[model samples]
Target: MRRKSKCVLGIEGTAWNLSAAIVDQSRVIASAESSYHPVEGGLHPRAAAQHHATHMEQVIHDVLAKGKKNNAKISAVAFSIGPGFGPCLRTVATAARALSLSMNVPLIGVNHCIAHIEIGRWLCNVADPVILYVSGANSQVLSYRNGKYRIFGETLDIGIGNALDKFGRYAGLQHPGGPKIEEIARKAKCYMPLPYVVKGMDFSFSGLTTAAKDALAHAPLEDVCHSFQETAFAMLVEVTERALAHTGKKDILLAGGVGANSRLMEMLNTMCQDRSAKFFAPDKAYMKDNGAMIAYTGLLMLESGAVLSVEDSAVRPNYRPDEVEVTWR
Candidate 1:
């Protein structure tokens, strides 16, 4: 008799995006996502959750259809369990539980932050690199030690992405302000001064955000954006370099949605080149909040004998990356 193919189905609804993917041990078979854009402000937890609830079923079906795999071949279901908006996390978790129970497959709860790092590591083929995680909701320098990915440095206030978005809002940019800010910043010929705050190994962006808002009242928008990127990326690079120096890690990986910024990548590449360390980042597909990363990481966890009962698959909106045990490593 021929052996049956086994795959894991992963769901990711951490924030604005509702995504799903099917992954076999070797590669991702299919991935699908739907993003919710706010009309005038940042993502509202309840509203985002409602959007996920409305579209999640269709998204899952689309992913499964794209893979062309039988549901019986799925051996596990994975969901990003947290460090996300409460309502969004709960909505995803509930869907995951229903699927797991219906299929009689194992349920796995993945850490959203860790999934970002794992996908970057897997795609880039980097082992044990210091991670610079910068997303809309998170900013941290992380490294694996003993059994967990510990935070070497982190944001004391707003994350880099959030700071950029808030600044964009103040300038009347649309939702998801990072990309808009980046676009305008590229046209700037001069960089205006902005607050650069890095205390010890940690960094803060609230002050910089405030300063940028104030500067916008007097300074040109392009100059302000340019200055903001320079100052913000500098803080991130500084802390990441410090972490690399302290950990002596020969590799540095950039993960998360904000990793898509060219300026940030350039800064990191320069720092890594100066230090003679390898720099790696996944393709844009895996950089943002996506289901493939969650699926792949979940597959690793399941293969390592980690299991979650349906009843225990509750969401943890405040889940920290370091709290998860690095069993695959």
Candidate 2:
């Protein structure tokens, strides 16, 4: 058999996004992403699954269309294996497996969180650093130590983004409320103070989010938004600083959707520079949920002969980033 450079088609249908990507050995050639329509309340699992089922095929087609435009053909298939809503993941997995079998290619399964970290490393090109993952469903400060990504700190109640979104919803904002809150916050003044909760290297946003919402009920909307942003950003900054101090790892990389916050990025950038430490965040495309990251991770894993079978495929809603077995290429 002739050996060929590794390429993988990555499919990621986690919570709200249905994404697909084609990655060659060197880089991502093409990608597609589709987000869930607005649900009245928070994530409605059945509705999310329905969205995935409806859009996943289109996402895959668009990804392949782009790849064909670039004359890139994948060698294998890879799908995010877990730490997401099971129904949504199953939709992607079914698509990936079907393609893999029909194309007579190997299939690789990737942990969504690990893929996030891997994409951060790929973009930042950092050797070792503390990684802060702040997304809709998770918040943690992690480091690769002792052969695994060790969690140094995490949320005690709700993830930062979740808390923010909940508060935004309570304020009569649209779904995926973080951006709406940030938009309102830009015009607001932070005259009122909010609590900043940072316990050791971990941070809590539930209290702050509650306080912000309550304040809005009695205070100006703009003021409440501004106060919320200031307090939440400060808490994140403090915890990040503490993680750096505790681990003695000056290098820090931010990943996931919350990493796109301008205020948060600016604060961390200044702090890192002042402390003579490095700080890195991926471009907006990589920061938000996408298939490119999964494709990139799958490319590496495929190159290392890490492939899986359909019978063994499963989605884990609670899969931790640190629990994945690492295989660096």
Candidate 3:
């Protein structure tokens, strides 16, 4: 008899978002997510983990219900097992283990960073491309070579999103600083001077952020936001352009929360146009941290015969994208 169709359920709780998604062979069937926003400072790992634990069950149930599937039909359970906060990663792992045991299905551990790249590739239908992964915690240029996604360039100090958030906090903006900064930057008519440091292919944002903060005392907020974004984005685009030239890749894929910024997208698009390369970025839903990417990537892993025993389902808080073996490709 022919085997039945398979569906994988993915859980994601790497940081502030608690998400669940169900995916079949072709696409994500359903996805649900709940995000925790700090009232004051940055995200607290313990508080974020507690939020995940509280909402994980409901989110999972909602996804399953939305997909119209029961536990009996699930072929595997996948969870992001690393490169995140310890408390949040552990919480998701525990939930994934329980679900795997209850359903008697295979368990898969996914690299959170790689999931972003895979989903972008899947969405754009690009075979091989230079990846610019930027988020609150990470900034790197990656390419697939020697059977793995290798990092060509990365942040030396702080990620771009974090830098923006810090600037926003200093400016008394809301929790997530990227969007607000982008909004105010639109009205900028003049640009201020800021530090632009790009060492070889790698870049540094700590110095630039400090300089931007200092400018806030004397310069208009709009000018500071504009200049800060321009300087930082120019550094990123420069590094990405260098990576493309070095790798001889004709396509560029932008993935991560920062990919949602219109100014960044415009800059990348212009650079790609000038360099005669293609640029691709997923929609907002897939660009940010979500369960759909996890579910889709997990489906690929499971199809490639990847199986994780409960004993080995422990989370890796410092998991790196290059450390994973790319069996699916």
Considering every candidate listed, which one attains the maximal lDDT? 1
| Model 1: per-residue Cα lDDT at residue 95 | 90
Tens-digit per-residue lDDT, 189-289, candidate 3: 89987888989889999999999999988999999999999999999999999999999999999999999999999999999999999999999888889
Ten contiguous residues minimizing lDDT sum, candidate 2: 1-10
User: Residue 257 of model 3: what lDDT?
Assistant: 95
Candidate 1: stretches off by over 4 Å: 1-5, 69-72
Ranking by lDDT: 1, 3, 2
Clash statistics: count for each candidate? 0, 1, 0
Q: Candidate 2 lDDT (Cα, whole model)?
A: 0.84
For model 3, the local distance difference test gives: 0.91
260: Cα error in model 2, Å = 1.2
lDDT for model 1, please.
0.92
Runs with alpha carbons beyond 4 Å of true place in candidate 3: 1-5, 69-72
